[model samples]
Target: MFGFGKKQDQPQSTIQSEFVEDVAPAAPQVTSVSSASTPSPLMSVSSITLPGAYLHPITKDNGIEYLFINENPMGVPAGKPKERMTGSFGPLPMRTNYDKLLYGTGAAYLTGFFGGGIYGAYRGLQIAQGNSFKIRYNSVLNSIGRHGPRISNSMGVLTMGWALLDNTIYSFRGVSDYYNHISAAFLAGAIFKSTAGVRPALIAGGLMTGVVGSYGLWEQFTSEKKETKIPSLAPAPAA
Candidate 1:
């Protein structure tokens, strides 16, 4: 037998092999969010601003009134004024209620002028077709029949003219931008009254008209502001 291969033996370590233990990661501790840190219950509000005009609505929560700028947290009240939040457009001053009322009434008056003209036209037509005609024997009186219908028509014409004047003069564009025109309407009303015998009811009506017009205009200025606050999910604050 030929000694072709000889086997070699290797020495093993005397220290016994120690097994490594597996460890798990510690779980994160959850913390509760406070109510004060969460959002409030109020919903979306609106705000608007224009040249020399500031419009916004007041919303109160928990006995505190908040004045929003554009109806959003975009402009929050860092502090309150010394007197009170009377009127302000966000960080700017807002128009008074009187102004708002005046704007609203002006719009109504303008609309009524057109309505009145239509009514006057209808009345003129009715009067002109009257079956009962009175003819006076007097030559002067007999000649006035033609003028009676003409007078009614003239009144209708006057009403139509007034409607046109109101449309042109008191329109939103005119009143908002043209202060001179606004003054002119008031002055004309006053000046014409003295010679024509100013009617107290008409004056009162005009004031009411202006007030309504101002309110309507004020409403248009406000735009909605959306908020992400969810009041229901928020927890109560600790005392």
Candidate 2:
């Protein structure tokens, strides 16, 4: 009776097998980090690729700052979305010929001319040393008064005329190319100088043709270079 009551010891392997079989394997001990506990890595990051085509782009309306993008942002193509011209003030949109003429090109020329006048004045003062502060101030004022508004207004008029011609060419051809720039520039010079004389108009037109043609060629070369250049590899995230 005592021997029968005593239990027999099972093999260690059998015990192990029995234990594995008896317990349904616990669901995988999965570990997960909750989203609520951490901020996303992608938030508030700036993009270097496209300025206006990024997650959010600021816009300007009639010289006033407006925090807005296009109404249908997704409709915009990836490569280039019409936002504003580079180096343009206020980041104003240049979608139409009128917009470019009124604000972009004309405004740029005006600003540049005025800035040039100021810079020229400073340079003159340096060249003619020993002038007193009052003299220097007067000289700068005289230079600015003589050059800034006068030259800038003249350039603005010329730019407006050129823009009209360029847009006309673009509309007729249905293609944006250097030819439009060349033709429009020539016409603008010729028309503007036509007031003086026929010879002046021809000479002005010829000079403008050369300048615009050279610029267009340079633009083409640079664009090609940009296309051919290899993109740099992004760095791997830290562990």
Candidate 3:
């Protein structure tokens, strides 16, 4: 019999539908391709800061990274809990003015005392001019005994003046910088040489400033702290 009625067409349609379902095409999948010209920068600077020092990031061609320290950044250090008197005094950093006075003066005095003792001994040796061991020993002793106390006293005065000015500035400004040191040196020098005259006092101030500034720069250049490995807390790329 010829299939001519609408009912006869139903079987063909059902078979076509079933065939389509069984052999349906799959959805196209996508593959990602990198289009960037270069990878992300490896030299990432950190925001982590240190008091009284600048953290400068540098990356070497060898894939090593370093944090270079720039001391006495001559500006307010960045951080929270920023408070006055939060700076180093002599050999130590302090949170109060009292410590700056007490410890700073003591440390400076001791340093000067020992330093003067050595200088005095050398001076005594030169003064004796004799090659004799006994003469050298006596000269050294005499020189130290005579000049040591005076040198120590003078050092103490200078240290005290410096500490006073340094502490006052730090307390008022709440920052540690190269200027503070320079100013303190100037004031201390001016005061120490005040009796000499205005010209001598100015000269002394200039000399003191030069000496302090030179030493600070030299320390920065020669110190091992100039370059340090990136701190463990800093962000780093995964291995």
Please report the candidate that would top lDDT against the real structure: 3
Could you tell me the C-alpha RMSD of candidate 2 in Å?
19.8
lDDT of 1 by residue, 82-198 (tens): 222123333433343333233324434554555554554454445553444432123223334444445444434433333343444445443332232234344434443445556
Alpha-carbon local distance difference test for all models: 0.34, 0.54, 0.57
**What are the per-model numbers of colliding residue pairs?**
20, 0, 0
Worst ten in a row by lDDT for model 1: 47-56
Indicate whether candidate 2 or candidate 3 has the larger lDDT: 3
Flag clash pairs in model 2. Answer: none
lDDT-based ranking: 3, 2, 1
How far off is residue 186 in model 2, in Å? 0.2
Candidate 2 lDDT, 36-108, residue by residue in tens: 4453455322211111212222221112344446455434454543433222124332445566566646565
- TM-scores, all models, native as reference: 0.23, 0.49, 0.50
lDDT of 3 by residue, 68-97 (tens): 453323344455422233334443445455
Which regions of candidate 3 fall more than 4 Å away from where they truly are? 1-81, 84-93, 129-132, 170-176, 215-239
